[model samples]
Target: MATAYVDYFPLYIQTGIEAGLLDPELATFDLARLAAAIKPERDLDFAFLGLQTLYDRYLLHIDKTRFELPQAFFLRVAMGISLKEENREERALEFYELLSSFRFMSSTPTLFNSGTTRPQLSSCFLTTVDDDLSGIFAGIRNNALLAKYSGGLGNDWTPVRGIGAKIRGTNGESQGVVPFLKIANDTAVAVNQGGKRKGAVCAYLETWHMDIEEFLDLRKNTGDERRRTHDMNTANWVPDLFLQRVEAGGDWTLFSPDEVPDLHDLYGAAFATAYESYERAADRGEIRVFRRVKAVDLWRRMLTVLFETGHPWITFKDACNLRSPQQHDGVVHSSNLCTEITLNTTVDETAVCNLGSVNLVAHLTGTGLTAAGLDGELLRDTVKTAVRMLDNVIDVNFYTTPESERANQRHRPVGLGLMGFADALFALRIPYSSDAAVAFADSSMEQISYHAIEASSDLAAERGRYQTYDGSLWSQGILPIDSLELLRQARNGDLTVDTGKELDWDVLRVKVLRDGMRNSNVLAIAPTATISNICGVSQSIEPIYRNLFVKSNMSGEFTVANPYLVADLKARGLWDAVMVSDLKYHDGILSQIDRVPADLRELYATAFEMDPMWLIKAASRRQKWLDQAQSLNLYMSAPSGKALDELYRSAWRYGLKTTYYLRSQSATHVEKSTLQGTDGRLNAVPVAAAPVAATPTPAPVASPITTSAVPATPPAPAPEVPMDDSLLDAPAVCLIDDPDCEACQ
Candidate 1:
């Protein structure tokens, strides 16, 4: 075997010089000493798949030649962050340690393109346009510019007047929002994220718009291709009045924005009053044209399209506006891409959020609620730490556009969210639907929301408050918990907590008023699709999809199991050929297994077993504390339109701002095996039945019988190779011993 000891110090210095990431004079200082500072052994930590992903996409390569090493990558990121800091080297080293230890990481765009020329690091962008000819096309150009630089765009199209109202200036009937949306869609396709990924945009419309029916069909395959925005995402910015209509079975009126100018600006009770007044105006024949449909009927069609094509996610305008710290700034029109960020977007100000997710599984300690359960104290501490990390990211992140930089710097907004929530619950053996689990969800998120605010307040004490923090909720000493006081006042006519739990509202409120906060918005729950997988835990706050399933990565397909389940079954003498067959028969559910106790069954119900309502309820509980929104996913085993309607309506009633991904399982069932074989590949015999009244026994310390009984041993460690700097920023390496980590996907 050949050994290669390529010194990384000179390479780092050279790249820093070439990229202007460091001063050229620093390149000559103690090259050998810096080389000694690099830990070569960290190179051994890379799993084969992680290495492959890095080689394929992450590592900086010039004409198929790799120049930087793993340590070099970390150094580049650290250098990028500490470029303006006074103690640049010390800060750089501290950041390097954090990244190397996997304590925290920047967003994908940041990791991919930072420290390089034309660095475009923001992940999401929001834009709004007026209905006029130039204004509408100007929005399209803005989308192209942002997308060209690898930023996700969310455009608010509410100001665009609906189809066929009237244009007095032209003396002609208008073509409406749909025609403009189609042009916006094509621009998204044309400027495809600099070929890094797909050009992504989300078009948001107010529900009162006359062209909403056409907007809903933009992603439908049968629609006229010219009118469809198949490449872009669509969302309905629904107000509370629409929800009330759906709840009351009342008629919904749609009209052009020209006729109803203030509809988009008003919300909650005021919006309802204005909408009713508009309906009366239409009834009096004061408006040009109008159509009335059952609110529930419109909601059902929205859900049906969501389930069918997975576009136009549901976003609540009332909830967003009511809870926003920037509510005084303007009515929050829409959430950004992925529906996790709720910020004020306008024609001039394009809302931008710098996002980061905490690894919840990393904070788990055995002393608390075990690995699979909720630990409020640990969670609180972790959230505080995460808030600091995300706040730091805002200062460190490279902005692609001037608007995003300005917006981010003014608000200093940071989204501190979690990955591995479901995995954490699984480790604690708490069922997703149980009251204990729901209470834990509420308490845990409340702590995160509370401490995150406190952490930001502490940061403000040192660095000063965000530019727009003065008139915000935090300035009024109203934290998320204190906001709940307002809700309590609204509901019961008093700012009192009749509930038994003695929440520490007074302390948080006092701190906020005294210290203020560094950031306007501190917390949000984003859908951890790619990041969660890298963390090797359940994606955000969703139930386990399956006990055993295939995760297809670039390297190849690999079978992953629920680690907690594997451990539990092994201890109970229940993990065997027969158990595997039973689990396979039920599509990874252990609920129907006669031997598995009811408690364990409840604790480990798959996504199919837990009611979709439970997911919404849990989200609602968490939403109360979250200032922005949650990337909530509702899962149904065999979904009907009626079931989805109920789930969405309940979400709306509970004051959820945004809902992402309506994941419904098909009615298709796996075919049962009927093949006969003595070797038991297909026809394994069941063991003798245990006593019906058998008491639950504690799991064994370890299984004695090994390879003789089982056909396969545990997988071996992947091979190592010479360190490649290009692969350092790839996804985190997966530890083979921890199967629960796979749940993050």
Candidate 2:
């Protein structure tokens, strides 16, 4: 068969013209000429799986007919990014190169709706519902409108009266927040974004609310389906006081907002003091009714439901409020859909975030350095470029709802996140949980945060300060680094930094105060599921779930191994059938195998092998720098209620604004050989066995001593499992299968 090269630009123009979306006058630009500009050979770089993923989801289609090819998709995104540029064509081409070459990617919503007549370019939305009937329905209408425009919603339901609360207007008891949440849930289902994707919402409640327990159980499958909004997400807007109570093993008193007012507006020690006073009031019968439960017990139950149902994502009320650039404007009641965005959303305004991710792996120079071993200069440049790109996205994006537009324009919030962290770590041969690895995480993120703020400040010089920037911490010359003083205060029970290595915060703070900031909040770490796959990197900051597993991409199922792991083992002459069998026996853990060196074991520790505390700690360190929040997923093997309780409490103590997904391993591990019917045959013959000692319990590596300091020791190598094609090829879902799937996508 003869292969023919066809210019793809003309194809896109023709399709657009045929669909009546593109004007013939715009065709003055030669499609073939533009096509010549594209390197057709780049098309070959896409693996069958990557190509299929684009075809199935990324490509713009009209009724099963694809109008936008891969090249067209890149062009459209480029056009979207460069919509406001004076040198539009040049900027578009530059963006096209970055996108097509897989250097970076816009968020999925942008990919899905850009260049369309109605572009809903935002990723998340936050709204608040009023207590009155009309106001409540109005909130539902707002949710529907935002959802119709492809925005995820986070609703603050703390103001609504709880069950059995008095309704003055009706002169009767109220049905409380639960019934209203059910309506919100049904509405999310009813309006499904014109069938493009499920309508996503996260309902948030203050811990003081009486309906808190029921709210936490909404995601439980065993619960009354009517009371549950399994479709929507739930998060607890926890105050520091609650966490302190849990830590002190004190009692927690629950009260309706109607009875205990002003609790939502307080933070830190003030909030704790007020809460304790409220408990005393309730005990004295000053409050109508209340329930007292052991704080740890309540925390344990929260974890229990989370372990089973996967939600009520933990977000710190105090941290979110204290760090908010919009704090002077209003108290931020809750975060948006994915918990990465923390903005002030009220009855009048809905918070919006225009998000994009930098492909960290792309920054690695081709000097045979893996993504994990990215050159510092390359990483810094990528972050600087990405900060600029996200800033541009804020200006060029077309908002679907006025409230969202208003929120985004005033705050000018943008989330500059990362993808391929795991891949990068693998390339660097660094364990995700090691002190050295944590230092890298801290330094890299601090660099991004520092540069992102600097970039926004530069934009502020060009444009003007954000609408609400006047009274912000930025205006006070308080950089995110300066906020460390607050954290040190919280950590040490007083404001003092005993730790050495003074950050260059004073300088950055001075610079920020002088220049102002273009955006109110500049940095957030989102779970870049689809974008990561597009860049062929690991998802977000998560570790690899397995070295070898079956990833069902759009093309079909294929086995994907950690390329770095495979290459390293191949170099060691240990890539063989027996090693594969060991991996199977160990459930993808490599530490127990004696053949694997200590260095590799430390470097290649799977998510389960790495302690949950390490994940929380790393996120905490990064959180100190981030103005908004992070999509930090905590992984645990055989997780208990107590384990989860401690994990979340620790997160709260560390002042993390938000926590995203809580993924736990099932108790029973499915031996791959048993599933594939090869177990008996594989184990029938006894091979030469290394006398292996019992697996040692991995200790939590201490936090990095300094922001820029490197650890003294390199990560130990993970033990080698004898390789078997069958075991290595175990089947699992690829992240791109459903780009809109809530789990990974």
Candidate 3:
């Protein structure tokens, strides 16, 4: 394969250029040097899942030949992103080293089309819907075009008027945002995102919207089919005032956007004052259409719907806006599809963000994670190069809509996140549920945040500041750490975020204020669902889902075992056929394995085994350093309204800008099959013969998943069962399939 890649790469490029699949401006001699620079041996780095994913969706092919090898694929993406650099060859080589070495990777979109004929390298697009008929239809049209090029969509539907509102032009009542959302939902299903993936879109309605009740039912199976947007994701654009009202048991009023138009734009104390005045107007019979309900009732309903159908994910409007670096430019109506991106959207400009992630596992040195294990200098270099590559994506991209192009040029926002966080934790031997893990989350994010900001500032000195640099948070010398204060003030110090710092942020702040910033926002932690597979790492900051399980995806099922766990068990001479049987019997949990050491078991606890608060605590630490937000997914073994309420409220109190999903274990279990050997005694299956696992089983057998941070005592283990092929069919944990759209990878 390596020899074929080296010999046929030129022919592949030539054929691609002739077939209109590649850029025709290439010089043959330069391509020759790049092709030779490819180190085919690095292909060995790919795990089965990662390599299969690349082969299935990413590698450039002609007539299914798949002539482009792994090294060539990396070089192609590197060359594509660095086309505009002064020394293009040198820059491409730098990017190639970063990517091919598995130290950094561009998002899936960039990897898919970076050096192609039309490079649509952006991941997420945010658009604000207008109230008029033409504008609504136009927004739908924009969704089709953007999805055609594989961009995930986030539409702000807050501006559309609710049902029962007067429509003066037609002399009729407005049918509400739900009908239009139904149309948008169908559009996303129809597009299919360039035939590579499904068209993913999320509709965001403010908590104050009168249609909030109907919006919450969009994902329910028993809902009126026409009113339900079963294909679309929904989230509540919650303001701090609403949560405060819920806490105080105050009355919450819902109004149509047409009547309370300013509420869509106002946030923080301004929004609170305006909302109260509107309520007073309603009480005096001044406002046209308004409904009042107990705030606690509405809050409970929100949590109930979330637990039932998983729609309308809880997101904080005030926290997103208050912490936005582009606050001076515009309002952040909603987050992008995966809930990581928080950018400003307007009528003329659709927000665009190019994304990439650093491989946290790649930067670790030494056996145990001491201060000396982190290679800060190497990380700094990676950040600088990754930022430059992201910046170039804006200039070289093929925009699907005029609004997206406008936004990309003006703000030039980019998300630089990290993958392999869980893998890093495993390598360092840290338990995910421990305070040590939380501290690591804080410290690691602080370093990443510091370097990302400094890199953007350095870029500004070289490439000039972004067009909207002035009057922004960077111009005011307030970085992400400083922005937490703004959220604190907005919540009147009710916020519970730990404002800790480890880096010399003071020096970076001065440098940013002086040199400006190349992008409006940097450092958003996207889901990294697909890209992490390509890098053979854990997804962005997620805890280990299982120690062993089968992963099901488009390509088929593949068994994935934790290498770290296997190695540890092997070192202790406990990793034999019986141990494998024990693992499968317990459904990939180590806490119940008596033979495993307590420390190793603690280090390898699955996501559902730990209390959900551990996830929140670590996420809160990372959130403080992030400019935008992280795609936080909260897990609960048995979800209840109260548990859901406490978990989401803690997220808000901790100042999380947005959350992605509410994952819970189902009530059913995968039927256990019996395995017997020649002697009619039960025997363990070997790794080679492990069968595929079932999907969506109950949370592993143990104490039910908790919502509190206080650790609970481990549940007693069950008596040993006879091992058989049945054990091999254990439930696959974590993300077995692509949960989020690959656009944000």
lDDT (C-alpha, whole model) for all candidates = 0.66, 0.68, 0.81
For each candidate in turn, give its C-alpha RMSD to the true structure in angstroms. 11.1, 7.8, 7.0
Write candidate 3's Cα lDDT for 553-600 as tens digits.
566666566777776676667767777777767767888889998777
Candidate 1 has what TM-score?
A: 0.82
The candidate scoring highest on lDDT is: 3
Badly placed stretches (over 4 Å) of model 1 are 1-6, 16-55, 64-75, 367-385, 396-398, 485-503, 553-558, 572-587, 591-600, 666-745
List candidate 2 stretches off by more than 4 Å: 1-6, 20-36, 280-284, 370-373, 487-507, 551-558, 576-587, 592-598, 667-745
Please, what is the TM-score per model?
A: 0.82, 0.85, 0.92
lDDT of 1 by residue, 336-410 (tens): 777888888767777877666665555554543244334557556556555655566567665655666778888
lDDT by residue (265-294, candidate 2, tens digit) is: 677767777888998898788887578888
Cα deviation of 724 in candidate 2 (Å)?
A: 42
Q: RMSD of candidate 3 to the true fold?
A: 7.0
Ranked by TM-score, the better of candidates 2 and 3 is 3
- Clashing pairs counted in every model: 12, 21, 1
Runs with alpha carbons beyond 4 Å of true place in candidate 3: 1-4, 367-372, 667-738
